[model samples]
Target chain A: MQFIVEDVVTHLAVKVTEPRIDAAIATPFKDKLREIVVKSRKPIHLDMASVDFMDSSGLGAMIAVRKSLPQNLGMVLCALTPNVERVFRLTRMDSVFDIRPLTAQKEHRE
Target chain B: MTPIERSEPKRSTRASAQVQPMFHRVLSAQPETVRDTLQDVRRRFQGEVSDDTLGRLELVLAEVMNNVAEHAPAGAGAPDDSVRLPVIHLCIVRHTNGLACALTDDGVSLPDECILPRSLPALVMDDLPEGGFGWFLIQDLTQALCYYRESQRNYLAFSIPFAQSGAA
Candidate 1:
């Protein structure tokens, strides 16, 4: 249950390094996300590029985390692998959450 | 104007055994073991089926096995501290049409409903659904998904077509 957090201009991007997020780490993952969500009022971006698989519990955990946040703050998912994306699509969660492609931002030309 | 004689599309005529030998393995009903078992199952069928089929199989297996580990008790009315770990038996076979999987667990049986939901519930912000999506995903991706309780054991079987076609 390791995540590498990156600071973006308007949000914090957390990259889940685990290949799979199933029942084993669902609860702990939710707790960790809660801690981060509460600490920062800015929007959060979950980078799931490395997560090739996510079962029901993992999907549930994500939903729980999103619900725990204050209404003002926001959470978005990005860079989901094809397999993981299917779960979201099949469950109709792609419409519920703000999902972005891997190329969410372009390099700053400063 | 000329009419072209069209040849019929060839259908798969390979025997089940020639495609892939039936895979069977028993594992302790634990989250870690279930995850490992799914990985092994995926590896075994990687080259045999399309990636989409493999992904569906992996998702279904994970949901079922994890449900067992999380909710199924070792014995009926057994004390939590004294309860023993249960075992799950998994079998997979490749048919011409698709892949079939059967899983058996000696843990507690499903609720009286004994059936999966027909569709996923709406994900509303006021009342979020943390769980209950497992069975929906399984039912959406599989064919002939059935469950039976007999002799104090839970048996589940389902099939995933090699092609991308599905009810959901």
Candidate 2:
């Protein structure tokens, strides 16, 4: 899986285009996220609209990215597809992250 | 040609019953091909599966096929050096109560240390997110799941209760 990082205002938006985010491809995705966070400003938004599947591996990577951000300035938000959203709901991680609708302003900002 | 005499042999054959018909198929390991194969299976079965069961079947099949593409050994110049082209072996068995599916592939077996936990909390807390949950979900959704390794092949089997209790 490859994640494309785009800088929107001061916040970084990361888009995951892969359909499956499980153990098989988690490491590459996490590595790319780490690379992006190191150079990003603050308030990262993860656009998971194209991601149809996410297992624990993907969730762990998201959490790791959240933790790697600057403590005071870092915020992580999720834009989940309906199917992927179900996974978040099932795992109750929706409560931890600032999950917004796919079409919400934060997600639509390109 | 008496009606009673002719029907007696037919009735006895039905009662004795030969071996149940078995179905098997092998398909390419491409991700796109997986969906087509699934659709074909559903069509061939004539919508025998309820909606809920169909959803579960799709999820489980996707999980296993994804694993095959990621973990199996790859041949030279394979699309992704990740795994050689995987040979997926699928078998469906019909029993009195339900249908059983056994999917076999030439991929690495589940790691010895990665036994699925018996409880959901253990799965949520002990397993780090972004990994180690596919098998857990498969176990939770299916009626039964088992894994075995023989020679160089990995066999994963799962079954669902098919006798309809009510509408899905």
Candidate 3:
């Protein structure tokens, strides 16, 4: 799995190229995201279109990313594929983050 | 009058000697490869199980493999580095009436003090703030689940009962 990091104004958009975002791959991704959050001054958008599955560890990673950012300075957005979306819903994490549909417009226009 | 004596039937003590097909492999601990392996396992064992059973098995395997990949031993470089050598060992055993799987990794074992909470649904739904729900799910779904740490390896095993079609 590959993680592409892009900076957008005050917010950061991370594109995860992995097919699954469960426990096996969540740690490295979480660490990368945390590194990004520590350096960025804006919200973080996790684009997970390529992620077909996400278990609890993946969810925990997201939560950890959310916590790593400065309070009131960082927000977390998730764009999840259908299967991954199902997991988020199953875990009721759908209400925790700004979860965008996989088909939603990208954060950057260009 | 003639008396007739009868002997009590002897019960077999051994587990049914049914031929259980076994499939096992140690694959790259890459998150991207898990789905393909799962699909192959399902396809090969299709008619013998139900969709729900397959889904449960897949979920368990995914969680375990994901744990191995993310936490397995390797210098922190990239996700690919996690699968350097002997990082993951997975086995799927199917019997005439049950299915079992074990996934092992050479990563740091789960902490001894870190108790996997029972309130996973509450944690996920209510944002209760704690983690380790994957362990919970693995324990919840399978009939038998255990975690063993041997030296540097963490082994997670799970099994479920296989429903038989009819009586012989």
Q: What is every candidate's C-alpha DockQ against the true complex, given to 2 decimals?
A: 0.71, 0.23, 0.19
Better of 1 and 3 by DockQ: 1
Fraction of native contacts under 8 Å reproduced by each candidate: 0.88, 0.30, 0.24
Best by DockQ: 1
Report the alpha-carbon TM-score of model 1 versus the true structure.
Answer: 0.86
Model 1 agreement with the true structure over B1-168: per-residue lDDT tens digits:
565546545447764226465679999788988988888888888888888889988998898888889875546235564776678999999987888899999888877443646667766768978877887887777888888989979998988878866344
TM-score winner among the candidates?
1
What would the TM-score be for candidate 2 when compared with the true structure?
0.58
Give me the runs in candidate 3 sitting further than 4 Å from their true place: A5-11, A22-24, A73-77, A103-110, B1-22, B26-56, B65-117, B121-130, B143-168
Order of candidate numbers by lDDT, starting with the best: 1, 3, 2
Q: Write the per-residue lDDT of candidate 3 for residues B36-77, one digit (tens) a residue.
A: 777777786777777656656777677767666666456544
Q: What is the TM-score of chain A in candidate 2?
A: 0.80
lDDT, residue A11, candidate 1: 88
Candidate 3, chain A: TM-score against the reference? 0.79
Winning candidate number (lDDT): 1
- After aligning candidate 2 to the native by TM-score, how far in Å is the CA of B63 from where it should be? 3.8
Estimated TM-score for each candidate: 0.86, 0.58, 0.54
lDDT of 3 at B8: 43
